[model samples]
Target: MTATDPAMTALAHSWSALSLLHGRIEGSVERALQTEHRLSAREYSLLDVLSRQHDGEGGHLQMRQVADSVVLSQSATTRLVTRLEDRGLLSRYLCPTDRRGIYTDVTDDGLRLLEEARPTHNTALRKALDQAATEPVLAPLVRAVHQLQGDIPRPDDRP
Candidate 1:
């Protein structure tokens, strides 16, 4: 379909709205996290992800997997890891089975910071969505998000 086609235009508009929603949420959460815990959103996300690792087989994630989860390139993820490591918030180690593979884990300090930032992150997210829901174009998207999260009851749940 041509760029000017009605369907194409609608698709572009939907994409733009989604991007705007993401940006608004991230920006709000970032500011709150940074102010309250001195942690950036990405740093908090990485710490949260690493904090969930376990001793069970396949519990720890490879660098690539961590990068994918955080939506960053492997090199960038490594750099972030290094920075956190320097701050004593994270530690890296070579995989026991494969010396070639490395894994990162959150330190006690990281876990403490993550726990403290959790409420701020959640509050900021809720505030962002609440504000966005007041906008005519974003209200539906906000509703859709709540519906997906099961925050809003589905029609199927109605008697």
Candidate 2:
């Protein structure tokens, strides 16, 4: 495809904007998470999922379930879990019903860290959104992103 092609030009513009926006938002959140809680964004995501999965009593999620929720690859998820395990933030155990299945449970420390980091993460996100809203070219995309995020269902949404 030639650089002059309309379709190619449009695709390039869209991709470039997406890449830049992603980098900025991710970097801001990552920095906040790291500085405040010593957690990576992916780590925060894992903890958030684990916390939400908890039922009335203590609850746990299978390794595969976690891998599915996060953006990380399966191997990367496993490695992250191991790192959290080492830090005593979370624990891994075999599912009682399925001996081969590994389940991850967030420890009290993990929950505490998540709660502390929540404010920083939220602030970073709000700042990003506010910045995007001020940029005429990005405002529409920002709205579209929020709409899309709301449209996506969480695990509890399934029947």
Candidate 3:
């Protein structure tokens, strides 16, 4: 399609709007988390993801999985994990069954910080969404976001 095609223009506009929405939401949450907990959003996300792991079979995530979940490159995620580990907020250990694999877990301090920062993260997210919803270009995306959340069935709802 030509650069100026109507469909191409529409797609570009949609992508731009989506990017803007993401930037605004992330910026708001980042500021709130940093102010309240001295944590970057990426760090908080890593802590949160690692905290959900369990001793049950298949409960723990691999390093690559953690990277994918946090939307970071493997190297970047490793660096982030190392920083948190140095701060005593996380610990890393070799995988039990696979000597080549490693796993990271959140520490007690990380959990405490996550709990405290949860409210700030959530509040900042809500405020950002509410603000975005007021804009004509972003309102539909915001509604879609809420709709997608509602559409996901809870674990308890699985048959």
TM-score of candidate 1 to 2 decimals: 0.91
Every model: Cα RMSD to truth: 4.3, 6.0, 4.4
Best of the candidates, lDDT: 3
Return model 1's CA RMSD, one decimal.
4.3
lDDT of 2 by residue, 67-154 (tens): 9899777899999999999999988878777798778888999999999998888888767766876877677777888787563333
Tens-place lDDT per residue, model 1, 1-159, is: 676999989989999999999999999999999899888999989998999999899899988999999999999999999999999999988988999988888899888888888878878888899899999999999999998866633324565
Error of 2 at 80 (Å): 0.6
Q: Rank the candidates by lDDT, best first.
A: 3, 1, 2
Candidate 3 stretches greater than 4 Å from native:
151-159
Inter-residue clash pairs, candidate 2: none
Superposed by TM-score, candidate 1 places the C-alpha of residue 44 at a distance from the truth, in angstroms, of: 0.8
Local distance difference test values of all predictions, in order: 0.90, 0.82, 0.91
Q: What is the TM-score of each candidate against the true structure?
A: 0.91, 0.82, 0.92
- Model 2 CA deviation exceeding 4 Å by range: 1-3, 55-60, 149-159
Task: Put the candidates in TM-score order, highest first.
Answer: 3, 1, 2
- Per-candidate clashes come to 0, 0, 0
